[model samples]
Target: MNDKLDLQSTDITAMNIDKIAVLFPNCVTETAEGKKIDFDLLKQELSTEIVEGNKERYRLEWPGKREAIVTANIPTTKTLRPVREDSVDFDTTENIYIEGDNLEVLKLLQESYLNKIKMIYIDPPYNTGNDFVYKDNFAKSGGEELFESGQIDEENRKLSPNPKTDGRYHSDWLSNIYPVLKLSRNLLKDDGVIFISIDDNEVHNLRKICDEIFGESNFIGCITWKHTQQSKNDERFLSRQSNYNLVYSKNILITKNFKFNRTEEDNKNYSNPDDDPKGFWRSGDVRSPNLRQTLKFQIIAPNGNIINPPDNGWRWSEEVLKNKIQSKEIIFKNDNSGIIRKIYLSEQEGRTPENLWDGNVFGTTRIANSELKELFGDNVPFDTPKPTGLIQKMAELFRTENDFTVVDFYSGSATTAHAVMKLNAEDDGNRKYIMVQLPEASDEKTEAYKAGYKNICEIGKERIRRASNKIKEEKIDKAKKDGLFSEFKDEQDYGFRVYRLDSSNMQDVYYKPQDYNQGTLDLFADNVKEGRTAEDLLTQIMLDWGLPLSLPIERKTISGKEVYSVAGDSLYCCFDDGIDEAFAKEIAKEKPLRIVFRDKGFKDDTAKENVKQLLKQLSAGSEMKVL
Candidate 1:
């Protein structure tokens, strides 16, 4: 099979070609009768480079355990219930108010929502001289001592700023931020972007860390926003009035696709003084250096005056000029101003945006705070919040109506969401926001706490409520004055849905006889009161079944008892009370794929046996189990 057939020159007439073809029929090829086959042409076409194939590689697994096992001396179990009913207005609106550790919330969101966010704007703690420090204790010993010593106090939390004198100041800050930034990057889509608001305290470090996470190629330019009108505490040098917004993109090419919206002022620049049939007109130079190289010519005005063209050349050639003169497409602005040409707006191309951001178009922080105060009366809890106009401008630049998702992880006072709502109110855009904030207790020493605010989350929620109310009020007042909404009565235009963060609903219910005692019953009772309804326990069972958590749940009264069924097509359960024969027969008649019942809720062993038999006879495809 590996033998070489022929190498040196061979005489085809001397050899019996037909006999040789028979000997190696598959390898031989014959051309049309009496036509010569060009072997050289075939060889030239078939010649190719031989490249080495890539090798198959295997990853080595670590021999040690991937996670550590530490004895938790104190109880750290928490109960998290859905706050949809409590908040009432949440989910129907576009805003979100999350209360918990942002890190944990971000992790929980990894599965259901990776690569789904459009934009993420975070204003994390600046790590100033007296700024609050977050204590990260992922793994610790003496949990009881830590809990009892008020280390994890719900009311009075710990916040020790990293002093410059501390040896691990930078290390501590990096440790606090690395995990969050890593997770936040996962939430961004391939075309998503991030805007980080930071001061001089850690802007440089933040950029380096972001580069490592989002790749240096994705680094967008930093925007310098004029944050203050006047700067104080100037001894020698001038006080800085601007703060930096570090921008980066998931992909630079994707971000470049974002278009800037033109304002009415920009549109007014184009005028149709000549009344050219092309809608609007503007003046443009009639010379070019690159595109019209061959168009250089001297122009003789109507007054018989000769005019020299630009150094480069005229924008059109003599042939093109003769064609325009015949068509009357070219017009001189007036008899005076050096014969300026008219360029119609319809003929003009769209302008690309410049990098420089104007403070007048957006606004300063003083104006932002004043606006906030006007909306929420004097002495608002939030000290510094971005103006709604600033965020609205960003939205106009990057987002379109009903097309983008905006996220603000460092949602101080929920200003980002407020801005999104305001923009949507104007243009009816469906931009959604996901806000994450640590439940940091408000400082008693600060005026915010003295105003009766408990934590930053409380202040954020209240701000959203007040902003929504104010927007509605303004809309109503405008509608009344315009006589457009006199018959409407209610003219509210803004609403929001709020969600809090917590642990997974799954809990191991299996316990040995020896482990069932008063303490276990007490724990179970506490879980029941914490809004852990029968439906909640059944959801835990569904998790154990490896079913999707978003399965549809239906409640039905069977045999004078409530039963929760998931998917309504399979997995029916009666967890409320004693299961009766009539209910079992009815469930069997429905013919679900799987049926479950509470083991302790059956009237007798006969009732359970009757259910199993009925399912086997009438619905042979069903499987029954007890919890």
Candidate 2:
């Protein structure tokens, strides 16, 4: 029995929600925005998850998936070593080229660049039968990696081909990629996005992982890019000519702001036939998609000919039709067989980008290979590299400002890097890039090895060098012809700093000082490795301080001791052999925001304290430390 009460004017939605809450109070919840209900909680209240004998309604799983999760969370003690000889602009460039394992590199960068990267575009191995999967070995120390860099022979490489004959073909590929994606998601800003390229071999699995990593709601779209122009006769059945670029955003609840401007051909469709004041106009069919008996009527054309309504019906009601006709917006053809509604060109916001990126609009594999071959003087080692135009199209949709940063961990042949530089040259933007590549050794039997390239990273570095020089040269030629380079002369920054992942500069004592016995305690004095240079220690210290490796550095002598000033005195390091109070006062006089002095540089413990106290006295706002 229920108590009867007088009914009142109320909201149907609130009443229905109250009824649900009365029956199941657990389903109701209050969100930060307002009172709301969690659908997942409601499902739990209903116990629908176990409706079919405890089976999951939907999920994607595979063997070793748990291991992948564990691997992503595992901590590492690695540091990046600055390689000046291998860098284009070792001290000034804002771009970075890292030669090492991408997963380890991403892990080390987590603190320094967390939630900072704007866009990422990676062309990873598609897990095809012949593709190579990274054999993630967490046991290997960073020192081991440094020693084995660029010498990844067939037997020693931490990679193996995943042929279909292998029992865990798909599983191995999944494990190889799962950790990298998980780590990469941590590096994206709130509005950041990642574009992953894959073929049919693993597109489905990749989508599942991406959905889990970047919530399903953040899925932007799966773009179908035409990779090849012609049909392949070698295919057994369907001739596949396209691949997918799965895009996901860190947060898509925000506005997309994606706009694809109409081409000249599209604008040609509009014409000012009557020379209207609102500019050119185009005629469209004046029919609605929905039909109703009220809209089913006959019309009389301007020529006195009767015309019946379309099957769908007129787009406007009787009153609306009369208003349009009075305004002269409803135009009749010369023959008067039909009617049309005029659409002004001013209201158009260009065409929206579709998922299908035709090969003609962007370049195909044939064109890409030809371009690469011509650029490299007839040696295109890569089988399929994305054309610069294709990447530029998507790059513009995301970031176009000077502060924008694009990351490409799997930067094969550095096409994305080339595209970034080209976009900067075209738009005069100062975009930064981070390119990471494994020094995967080339087999002696391959043409790349015979062409004087020892590893894949060599090819990628050379490509960036050639592309940067060419872009600069093209800009100079154009500026010279147009005579408009008053400000553009010194604005181009087409250089990158090269850093390789290696062991920490701090010797074993830095990790656990208490574990050293009397015999090993003597070795702990000046714990940095023997061969490590001042630059190497400076690089590690920068990482520990969460500073970007791309910051500009300046070297000068202070009181007869060499000091490296990073980012215009944002951080200063004096890794010299000796440090007296006189030298410390000289460094303090410069007033660096953050400064580090070598512990061994001091004559004694009292000398270190005197220098630290004098620095705090000289510049109270500065942070002073001794390593």
Candidate 3:
């Protein structure tokens, strides 16, 4: 009996070895160092490490979930561009307003937009006592409950502050921000940069988190902006008047290509009075210890009187001085007190921007708010909106034209989108913006909501509307006055396509014949609504397929019904019993990889056979399913 058991065990061991060999073709290898390399062992070791790493990550993780649906359908309402009556259309204008939790939106954008963004600027909640916490609730059946509530009212809304007294105060903030930062990093190009606005409360935490997310090597300098000019007397301790903007890049090595733009103000200081024919030039001190070592030098005046140098010696070496004099580069002052040389603006290169940004050129929040009030009415909805000048300065430093896409996920009042629009309009450039804001209700107790605003998203949409209207009106007025209008029509110029987060449109319809009821039939009928084209359903199908969200779609009419195709591969269709042999043949001619159709679309048994035959003829590898 023991000998028989040993034989059986040997057979089992041999069978296991054969299975392993089939699973891992390169399991055994001989290294050049005369050592045996077991790929199977190496893979097992790596898998163990991965499992342990995942366990550690989960151990430190906070409990929360995203409240947004990742889908493929780009919101048609969000792409509102002014239609031209006569002028030829060119590029697609993108000023996107996504109505969803930004966390899911970031994930949805990961595939098509990885390493494509130029700059990301976020003005998240400051974690102050009044700031609303992002309570993610995904357990609800109908998509995101908070977002599905549409426009929230002040009475039903909850905007609690993240007080320090709370046990999970810091953890909550970290949980809310970690996934977002990690996802946003994927959207940044190699040289892409991000600027985060924060207060003293979470600056240290933000720095540590950013270092971990963006890599410590990618950290740039932190900029301190004077948020408030006045120091409050009500505070017992030192009053805080500044906020920090932490900057980081995807890769500092790639960021070396970035250059600061010289403003018009900086260029205005240069002049060309001497006409040295060297273009523009700027003056520099001519004296240096290595070049000019003499303690003093003598200068001969036009009147033949000898002028002694002051405490400082000559600006250049004796040889250089002789060369300048010979070339007539040096000039004598008319007063005979000293000799001054002319500097040409064309002769000098541009200067680098300094760390300190003055409020004059890049206006402060006060100026920005005042401008908003001027454009809209006296009562602005939100406070502390960043100025277009400031964003423009940053944009100039990072990118140009449509070369990069900019995102502001924590877009308060849509200021970053407004700035992007204004910048593009000024330069006729095609820089795109993706703005995401929660539909949190405004506080009726505060001055803003009491003035008739309901929620934060309402304010954002209104701002975009007003800004578009103003830009269109100005352009029309200018065109009319200049007589440059040759058939241009101003047809609602500025608008963004609006998309709200929602679940997959597919319904679970695998009902048994015995269990079929009126409710199931009603759901099926509702799913196949009339006037809704197949393209709409196909878009939702693509989302369910986990395909690229930005896939190009095309539509064609077959048997008087529209059949939608995505990426020339997936076909989605639905129609009443009119789908016949000819229709199936035409659809199969496209050679789709997958075909989806409504169960009731087939006319009879003959129609199903025709579909099978067409698939065999044109698309042999095609898979078919019924919704």
State the TM-score for model 1.
Answer: 0.66
lDDT of 3 by residue, 393-489 (tens): 6777753344456789988788887777777666666677777776666767755687777777777777877776677777778888989778756
Mind giving the per-residue lDDT tens digits that candidate 1 earns over 235-305? 37868777778888987877645556655666787887656676776666777757455666776766766
User: Which is the leading candidate under TM-score?
Assistant: 2
Candidate 1, residue 100: the lDDT equals 69
Badly placed stretches (over 4 Å) of model 1 are: 1-80, 84-86, 90-94, 136-158, 233-236, 284-354, 486-497, 503-531, 534-627
What order do you get sorting by lDDT, best first?
A: 2, 1, 3
User: How many clashing residue pairs appear in each of the predictions shown?
Assistant: 3, 0, 18
Between candidates 2 and 3, the one scoring higher on TM-score is 2
Model 3: ten consecutive residues of lowest lDDT: 78-87
With candidate 3 superimposed using the best TM-score fit, by how many Å does residue 355's alpha carbon deviate from the native? 3.1
- Which structure among the candidates has the greatest lDDT? 2
- Screening candidate 1 with a backbone cut-off below 3 angstroms (N, C-alpha, C), the clashing residue pairs are 90-497, 90-498, 91-497
Model 2 pairs whose backbones collide: none
- lDDT against the true structure, each candidate: 0.65, 0.81, 0.65
